[model samples]
Target: MTSSDPHAPHCHNVPGDKSAVQPDKKRLVSRLNRIEGQVRGIARMVDEDRYCVDILTQLGAIRAALDGVAMQLLENHANGCVAKAIGAGNGEDAIAELMDVVRKLKS
Candidate 1:
């Protein structure tokens, strides 16, 4: 049976090619590293009997940081991978995939 879900992953038989972000990859990695540290800090706070409000604030910051990362990734994917695929005459597939991603993001 075939699934109608557009967000479903499937094997496309295409060779995996590396796509790079327009911005510095090191900077992105650094941001992610900092987020990871924040997570660890939150864990330590929990263990150390920190206040609930402070923990909640840190969690909110983590969520915002994660959202920022997601936006950066989406922008990079659009400009690099989708654009390249469209330029190669596979825009329909790329657009469909992008739509699926957008739908999932909305959900």
Candidate 2:
């Protein structure tokens, strides 16, 4: 699941370590950059005492955008990391870990 692509999302279970490299990292990072900007804008709106409804609307958009990113990463994890785990006969643990995260995301 680990990729040599420098821009990829490398995630690792090791303490203080990064692991698997998810594809399309540049796009993912771009999306996250936009989300960060939106957050900043929302903060500015709050400072300016903008209307509650307008702020709430932006907040909703932010939530949706974050959800999109989460789903993308989730899919990549399944297709890459989980798939690898399954091939290695460690699918049970991988699947359990996946479901745990899925449950957390639902909440």
What are the lDDT figures for the candidates, one per model?
0.72, 0.82
Q: Flag regions of model 1 displaced more than 4 Å.
A: 1-23
| Tens-digit per-residue lDDT, 22-55, candidate 1 | 4446667899999999999999999999999999
Report the C-alpha displacement of residue 44, candidate 2, in angstroms. 0.1
Clashing pairs in 1: none
Q: What RMSD does each model have against the real structure?
A: 9.2, 3.7
TM-score of 2: 0.85
Task: Give all TM-scores, in the order shown.
Answer: 0.77, 0.85
Cα deviation at 31, candidate 2, in Å, is: 0.3
Cα shift from native, residue 51, model 1 (Å): 1.0
